[model samples]
Target: MKWIPQEVETYLSAKEYVDTAVIPVYSLSFGEEMKQSAAAFEFISLLTGYLEKQFTGRILLFPPYTYLKSEHIENVVSGLSKWEETVVQNEFKHIFYITSELDLRMFENKVDGSLIWLPSLPLGNMNEPQKIEVVESQAKQLLSIFTQKWSNHE
Candidate 1:
C-alpha cells in the first residue's frame, strides 16, 4: 500500500461526495488579437479535471486563469477567504492547492511544517531527491524565523 498523508488518505477513502474547483492559467492575453487558443483552454480543462479526481474533491482553490479578467488580480488578497467559503459550504477537510509565488506569495508567508514547495521540473532528467533536500532545508530555515514569534505567545 502507498503511504499517503492522513488528510489525503481520508479524502480518498471518504464515503461522502465532495466538491472541486477546476482552474487554469495562460501565457497570453485574449483580447490582444491573439485570441484565446483552443489548445490552452483544453489543456487547462484536462489537467484541472485530472487533479480534481486524484484528490477526491478535496481541492477547492484554483488560480483564476482559465477565465480571469484584469480586475480579478486585484482581489487576490481575499483569495483565501473565497476558498474558505467554498470549503465551508462543501464541508471538506482536505484541499489540494496548486499555485506559484506569483500568485501564492511564496516568499512572504511561513509555510506549515507539513508543506513543501516543489519547483517545476522534469524529474526524470535531474537529481530530484537532492533538489528536494535542498528545498526542504531552506524551508526549515525560513520556518524557523517565525517560530520565535509563535513561541513568545505561548
Candidate 2:
C-alpha cells in the first residue's frame, strides 16, 4: 500500500499481516540524458504501482528514495541500509528494494534488503498496450521472486 492516509490507517490496524515493505530507489540523471531519467522514473512508478496492487495487503510501498546518479556507491548503499532499520523496527520482516538503475547493482550486497534490478524501459513513444505489456511482464518477474521469498520464509 502507498503511504497515503487511508492506507496508513489500514496499515496500522493490519500491521500484523503487512510484513513486507517495498522501496523503489531511483537515481536522478543529470545532463542531456534527462529524458531517459524521466522515463526511468515513470517506468518505476508503473512497475511499483503494479507490485502494490498485487501485494497491497502484505506490503507497504514507501515513497521512492531518489539519489544522484553520480553519488558514491558506498554512501548510497550505507544510507539505504539504514532505511531498512526503520522498516524492521516498525515490524516489517521482509524488505525489498527495487530499482531500474543498473549501476546500483554494485552495492546490492551491501544493502540491508534484497535489491531487485530491473532493465530500464524507455516509454518515450510507446502505445498504451506496449506500456501495459512491459509493466505486466516485469511485474510477473517480480512477483515470482517475491513468491519464492514468501515460500522460503514459510
Candidate 3:
C-alpha cells in the first residue's frame, strides 16, 4: 500500500475535512526482518518522509507494536534490535501501538513516554470479564510510570 499519510491526506483533502489520524497498529516483529517479510516499519521511512513533506508540523504517525505471539521471542528480539531506536525517535505528535500478552514484561524497559499501548485480547474461550481483567493487570503495570491513555480492543 502507499504511505498511510498520503492515503489519509488524499481522502481528507478531497473531502475538505480534518480528522485524527489513526494508523493501524502492526506487529513490530516485521521491522527486524523486513527483508524477509512485509511490515509497517519498512515503509516507516517513507511515512516519515511523507510527514516531512506533507504535514511537517501537523501530523503524527503512530508506530506499530509487537502484538500477540506465543513463540516469536526471537523475532521480537531481532525487531527490537533493529528498529527500536528509530521508532523511539520518530518525529510525531504521538506514538501509538499494540501490546500482546507474551511481551508485557519486556515492555517495561523498552517503553517510551509518548507511546500509547493497546492491550491484546486473547482469542478463543476467554470471556469479556476475563479479558478485561487481563488488560487491567497490564494497565496497572504501565500506570506505575507512564500516564498515557490506553484502550483495549479484540
- lDDT per residue for candidate 2 within 33-52, as digits (tens), equals 68888888999989999999
lDDT of each: 0.39, 0.88, 0.40
Query: What is the alpha-carbon lDDT for the whole of candidate 1?
Result: 0.39
Ten-residue segment with the worst summed lDDT in candidate 1? 111-120
Model 3, residue 93: C-alpha shift (Å): 6.1
lDDT per residue (tens digit) for residues 43-109 in model 1: 3333344444444443432454332435354354355445545654655433333332244344224
Q: RMSD to native for every prediction? A: 9.9, 1.0, 11.6
**Candidate 1 local Cα displacement, residue 94, angstroms:** 1.9
TM-score-sorted candidate list, best first: 2, 1, 3
By TM-score, who's the top model here? Answer: 2
Q: Candidate 1, which segments miss by more than 4 Å at Cα?
A: 1-28, 33-40, 55-69, 77-80, 99-154
Better of 1 and 2 by lDDT: 2
CA lDDT, candidate 1, residue 59: 46
TM-score of each: 0.37, 0.95, 0.33
Candidates 2 and 3 compared by TM-score, better number? 2
Give me candidate 1's TM-score against the actual structure.
0.37
